[model samples]
Target: MQAHFDAQQRQRSKLTELGLGLSIDIVAALATSAVVAPFVAIIDRSIISNASGRMPLMAGLQDGFRTLATRPAVLARQPSVVAVFSVYAITYITANASETIALSANADPLLPKFLASSTVNIAACVYKDKLLTHWCSLGPARPFPMASYGLFGLRDSLTVAASFSLPPLLSTMLQSNTSMSKTSCDSISQLALPCMVQFISTPIHLLGLDIYNNPSATAVRRAQVVRRDFIPSTLARMGRILPAFGFGGLVNNKTRTTLKRWIL
Candidate 1:
């Protein structure tokens, strides 16, 4: 009889443990879904609207506001809610926005441009010293230290590419008049008034990324070196890039109009 009672207690404990774990998992999944759903909805709506030549901005605004309102409450109660929202916001504002702006403006696509420029610049910088040493060690003196000069030239090439690509992309994404898809716009409108709430809340997402991914000392040191030594030269080579990016709205308008005409 005692053995039977002990067995029963053991079974009960096991069941309780299993239930507890399952409960936690369920809550986690629910939280994740809640955060991701908004972002996914926004992206899907934006893409459909853009592809169909409809406006999606209102929808974005609506969604943004709704998210802002609910976010604080959800985060206050559950910390994980904060993380999920942060990821969604970053993905939407940074990656998705860049894509949208690029497509709308008819500028070089953001992904390809950023990838190509970053690759070239990183490669040239990494190899600069090595290449110079190889050339200089060959003899008393080479004709003009072509390798060292070539590194500067490669860096210049990267700057030119970045400048050409960054302006229109940023402009189109940030423009106020750009529209969202009908579905997304509807979703936004349904959220209620005071859409600015979302905009105010959006910065939280940016701050999260900066806090989470901030560089270590090594990274800061390297960036500092790059900025000090390489930035000026690159800027001179690609002067047009900064102007275009700085006057984002104007560039966006020009790029979008040009693309629209070309496509039509």
Candidate 2:
């Protein structure tokens, strides 16, 4: 009778944990999205504008907010703006919810965190990129190529690893070597890795955008676009990535942790 009672208690505990976790995820997602979405939305527009050859990098950066300051109503109507907030909310909810489940199951949370964040980020980003590419086009919408998704997936996966998986490991190493607090280490690792990973992911991102934007262009022309855009696009991407993954990830995780401690 005692053993059976203990088993029942354990099952009840798991259910309670799950409920609490989902509540925390909702709160964290909202909190992070409220803070991060505006910056991400602007930087995202800049990257896409620069990639699509709509404008030069510096001009694109300025133009993102220029529309907002000058024409708030028009900026409010843009689909990409809505997509940015939605993606951030969805990503944080999935990331923390999966981690919560892994904890309840007595499993390593890192793998679930990595998998959930990576899959959701890649899908959300590819769809957003496709939408923005068409939005920026002077011509009518063309069919999106499958190859674009494949390339974007590869790039986003590397970024997901840098954002979710590698940060904890990097923080651990940093903490071991230095006397900084865990928060400091976590912040540094979160910010630094995403910026560094852009070097590798930027070219792939530009190539994927080129292919999607001008699917009929020759290989030589595609290569030339990639080469020409490489430096500015890479720099623009690094700026965008810092807000999206670096500060965003850190803020989301910290909010989840703080909320869990306070309420759960």
lDDT for each candidate structure: 0.36, 0.84
Model 1 residue runs over 4 Å out of place are 56-264
User: After aligning candidate 2 to the native by TM-score, how far in Å is the CA of 153 from where it should be?
Assistant: 0.9
Report the lDDT of model 2 for residue 189: 94
* Candidate whose lDDT is highest: 2
Per-prediction TM-score to the true structure, in the order listed: 0.24, 0.91
Give the candidate number with the greatest TM-score: 2
Model 2 agreement with the true structure over 11-114: per-residue lDDT tens digits: 99879878988998888887887666666777777777777767666886687778878986676567777888788788888888888888888999999899
In model 1, pairs of residues that clash are 55-179, 55-180, 56-179, 56-180, 56-181, 57-179, 57-180, 163-241
Cα-lDDT of candidate 1? 0.36
Model 2: how far is 223 from its true place, Å? 2.3
Q: Count clashing residue pairs per candidate.
A: 8, 0
State in Å the error of residue 62, model 1.
11
